[model samples]
Target: MSSNALDQFLNENLEDLRSKGLYNEIDVVESANGPVIKIGGKELINLSSNNYLGLATDELLKEVAINAINEWGVGAGAVRTINGTLDIHTQLEKTLAKFKGTEAAIAYQSGFNCNMAAISAVMDKNDAILSDELNHASIIDGCRLSKAKIIRVNHSDMDDLRKKAKEAKESGLYNKIMVITDGVFSMDGDIANLPGIIEIAEEFDLITYVDDAHGSGVTGKGAGTVKHFGLADKVDFQIGTLSKAIGVVGGYVAGKKNLIDWLKVRSRPFLFSTAVTPADAVAATKAIEILMSSTELNDRLWENGNYLKNGLKQLGFNIGESETPITPCIIGEEKTTQLFSKRLYEEGVYAKSIVFPTVPQGTGRVRNMPTAAHTKEMLDQAISIYEKVGKEMGLI
Candidate 1:
């Protein structure tokens, strides 16, 4: 029989989560994840995907992916350090370096693995990492895996970062210190102050790392956050995901050639884990080429974002401070936020509610992600549904 202790622990925690309205119930989409999705035989205006530029469903990308499958087959069949390093993989890395304005780059199977691989490869128990409190969960796990002394700094507070950096340096207890942050805070959707952070990094001689998973295609004219602030040569580690804006799978680190070389040798994930599929590599390369060639998709994305934000604001909803396209409509309680999302689903919109644990308590919200693929007509329909649901629930 299965272990009773383990089963009991899971059952109790699952029950607790359900009772508190914190447990998430995932929905399956029958159709492609595009501007609209089919869930349980009902169509919805999908405003909850990370497919920012809508390249996931682009005809060009789909064609390239099919070509790649025909040419390279499906899988790489080995870890990167083994025989998995295909020419397309190298091409993808080179394109990523150019796209991010970096000297060289390396690829990983997932953005989470990029962190899990890169951070531990560079840091150790002898080192320390100063991280923003609002950074992504992947970042937190990566820092933990490093076995470094993880020091939490106040979110986007330059003074607190400087103070902590100074203290960590002055104590001389650690051999190296790294300050890591997200280029875009995903939940609240604010850009990171890279210039300020770089200034402090210079003063402290600390390594700088920016995970621009949410900022890459949406910011910097589609180059990324590092290039957005013209600090391309200043930052040490630039991390991004191919799945989000690139509309494929995998992640990468763009930096100096030596750093990438070192990671290829030392990063456990690269040495042990299999690389991304050939189709993913080829599709991502084509996506980056599209972004670097033009900003049409990026512009359309911003227009849709602004249109939706204005619609929600005019209808009397609290959208938190978001400089980027990610918009969150704040609902005070967990249950209420869940109810709001449910009502939205019933009204043919598909934005999900983020509750406590993902965010702080009493600050739950239904996050909306508008894509380049969404037309003005689709956005208008979504806004009308939001208004209908909001008024019925007394939210607006």
Candidate 2:
């Protein structure tokens, strides 16, 4: 093939992304990711990140990663099925199971891959998956890969979930039925009704899957949404990421030993991909230890969250209903939302705007992630910027 073919393919896709306004231009962070970050030679209060507990730059986690790197080289050599299952991997899985209050756990290279691996491993063409309309993209892809019949219920509408579950069960169109939802909806920060989901699952005998990517280290006093609702035992699969709050890279599925065992033997990712680095495994384990030691970080995180949320609401910005730290300043137009974020950035705040297809049209907004590391002064400054931007944009 001619080299022009590759160039043509790239140019066409790049043009399409630009036309859609979804071609995100990369911004270089000049300093460590934290409450305050240096970008474009300007220091700004960072409101766009997933480092909830601020452990991404924590000294403890750094030390653990360093020590682990010193002890065991860098990569894990091969797939877990071959020789990549290191002792640290097993230790991390055990620690995760204990942290999530589950009987067993399995780890994957990335949270995204965890969904790709676990969902396909258990459910297939003959299965039916009842998912929330707003579930994460990873979950949607996982369901598609499973070749299962996917039925989306209204966001947090337990009645719809129940009706669908009952219908799927009675129809006998599937060999198995499963319910999947995000423990915390990332966009709105609204928590899933796990208790209601469990009730429906029990009534319908459906498998329960909770993806707590945004909930872990932020809810349930740091354990996650399942623990928040005391459904750790009731939920069949408790999915989580080690990257966000755990300050490392990888994903996990916590559930009964049988489910994990089945995944270990069948999940293609685990069988084909190399395990996480020793440093990542050790750092994640250390992060979990910190979470288990006390709720101090979790409390501080919420404190910062509430402080920022209250300030934003008081500033007359239409922040939607959110029970978690993920706050969105609802600016209802795509261009306006993007402009609001740009204005805020110019004013020394680094919050990014999320627009259509990340969310429904006309519900675009700038999402703020307040971490435990944010000081009161930092939040106040952010509030001031929001007020100025809101006034300038006539969004107030």
Best by TM-score: 1
Highest lDDT against the true fold, candidate: 1
Find the 10 residues in a row with the least total lDDT in model 2. Answer: 17-26
What is the alpha-carbon lDDT of model 1 when measured against the actual structure? Answer: 0.95
Q: Which runs in model 2 stand beyond 4 Å of their true positions?
A: 1-20
Write one digit per residue (lDDT tens) for candidate 2, span 163-207. 999999999899999999999999999999988999999999999
TM-scores of the candidates in the order shown? 0.99, 0.97
Q: Global lDDT of each model?
A: 0.95, 0.93
State how far residue 64 of model 1 sits from its true place (Å).
1.1
lDDT, model 2: 0.93
Model 1 TM-score relative to the real fold: 0.99
lDDT per residue for candidate 1 within 1-396, as digits (tens), equals 999999999999999999999999999999999999999999999999999999999999999999999988999989988799999999999999999998999999999999998999999999999999999999999999999999999999999999999999999999999999999998998999999999999999999999999999999988888989999999999999998988998999999999999999999989998889999999999999999999999999999999999999999999999998999999979999999999999989999999989999999999999999999999999999999999998888
